[model samples]
Target: MSATSVSSDRVDHLWKGVRAGVPIFVASAPFAVLFGAMAVENGLTVAQAVLMSAAVYGGASQMVGIELFGQHVAPWLIVFSIFAVNFRHVLYSAAIGQHVPHWSPLRKAVAFFFLVDPVFAESERRVENGKRITIIWYAGMALPMYCSWILMTWIGAEFGSQVMPDAHAIGLDFLLSIYFLGLVMGFRKRPRWLPVVLVSAVVSVIAYRTIGSPWHVSIGALAGILLAAALPPRAALPLEAAAVEEATS
Candidate 1:
């Protein structure tokens, strides 16, 4: 393709990613708001809470961080906790890297920073369909979600006490669980996904009750990874397998 055509295609894909990410952003908003509210309740100032949201951009890890901060945990331990919670990103990067081998180091670094669950999902879907994935497309999906998270965090910090005095009573806290459930449902048809998920959940609950906090997340993820690695590789689905399977049913 000519330079102009390539640029246009990139822009088109970028918007496509943005559109795909909108629903995820909506689904995540409640959690983001709750994170902010909880951060403030844990003694974080509005600025500190918002800054955490902007810098970390991982809702689960940030919430853990806030809890640790409130407990006066050692700074290094807090860092480790956040790292453990976010270690799954390493796997996410590895999976997406296959499609962008020639990306510049700077582009790769920026992309990795924004590589959240929704962005990774959309990118993986595109790659599975043999579509070209571009940095612009990934950024398009990431930036808007990032902005929404930060904005909601600020709102929650500023008004949570008054507006959401009883967030739990209103079920705001359950939104993240529902959102994650929806994500997991999407992969239900994939081979071996069930066993992996079940193992992860069982291990995670045990770890949470015994070891506690960030360790549970890391342990659960590692358990899933190890189980997956031990399993024999499944055959790749044919490009039209989804359509064929759907039509038969």
Candidate 2:
């Protein structure tokens, strides 16, 4: 192929990623605004709220931090709470690492900064369909979401409550959860998906009932990760051997 053709391919892939990421950003945009408003309400300046969104880029953890900050909680507990809420990113990085072996250390560092749930899901879906995870494509998807999040945060800090009056009264809080459910269901066809989902759901509920909010989310996810790692599909050699042994026994 000519250099011109290669350039065209890169732009095309980048555009494809941008298109793929729009829906995610659209779904998440409201929550960004909500965080900004809530952050301001919780005593953070508009700049601080936007900075946190830009730097941390993790919505759940950001909210947890904001709430803790509002309560004048100790700095250590607030940091620990954010870490607990974001522990799933550790699992996400581990899962996606195999697909990006060609990436340089710096590239991986930059790319992983935008590794939210939607990005991780969409990347896995792209890989499952046999496409390589190109930098152009990843940035195309990531930039819109990342930039829009900060933009929305500013808007919310400046005009969120004034515009919406009562965001929760209108049920904006449920939108992200609904969007998350869609992401989870997108992987339903993967091997052992349902079992992992069920186990995670059950464990999450149990943890919520006993241990409480943020911990339940992380603990539930950890349970699912453990199950997925320990119990491969029956087609795998170790699983096949176990099946054979059980059958003979």
Candidate 3:
């Protein structure tokens, strides 16, 4: 596509992505409620829980933050651990950077603040050519999700203890797994990408044993990148075609 065509398509795609992603944000409600319940279980005050949702705005990081805080890990370690867990966002930023390259540093930083795993995965899939997807689409996904998270967190912190006799047993934590699976099943249509997922899991296990908590995510990211580099597919479409062929054959 011509540069102009690509830019225009990107904007169009961004608009569509925003519209499509709005439902995902709405679908995130139950999970946000679960996060709030988890926050309360972790002994966060309602204010702290809500603020963490607003400030961190990253589900996995907030979960990890609560876990670290509950363990009484040093505050500096908690900060570094959450940062390490979230560092993969740097890669996400790089992927979508072209779409918004001309945006100022302040604007970029603001966009980065709302960057989370789901929005990153969704936006990356929708981007084309070298054009950057507009940050507004990301905001469209993040802002409402953010509000839902904070409000639900406040409610959970206030009332969850009174209601759920065993919140963990109720399986609220599974929402995290389900959310991840949704992202993976969406983008990982290629057989080659399957190996990256496996390698990432293996690396995470190894890192969990050797490096422990926060550093494991860093190792997993490195392993994932290496795996992707090693097993580059011909194209995403070819992978889909291969799957169809296999199923028919």
Q: Which candidate, 1 or 3, would have the higher TM-score against the true structure? A: 1
lDDT computed for candidate 1? 0.79
TM-score ranking, high to low:
1, 2, 3
**Candidate 1 regions with alpha-carbon error over 4 angstroms:** 1-7, 167-249
- TM-score (all chains, Cα) for each model: 0.71, 0.71, 0.63
Candidate 3's C-alpha lDDT? 0.68
lDDT per residue as tens, model 3, 87-198: 6566666655655777789988887776665666555555533434666556665666667767877877777777777656876656567755665565465456678888
Q: What is candidate 2's TM-score against the reference? A: 0.71
Candidate with maximal lDDT: 2
Give the CA lDDT, 0 to 100, for residue 222 in model 1. 84
**Clash totals, every prediction:** 0, 0, 2
Sorted by lDDT (best first), the order is: 2, 1, 3
Candidates 1 and 3 compared: the better one by lDDT is 1
Residue range 1-249, candidate 2, lDDT tens digits:
999999999999999999989989998898899899888878999999999999889887898788778878568878888887677577667767778999999999989989887888788778879999999999999899999999999999989768777757876555546645765675565567788999999999999899976567668988998999899456644432322222222
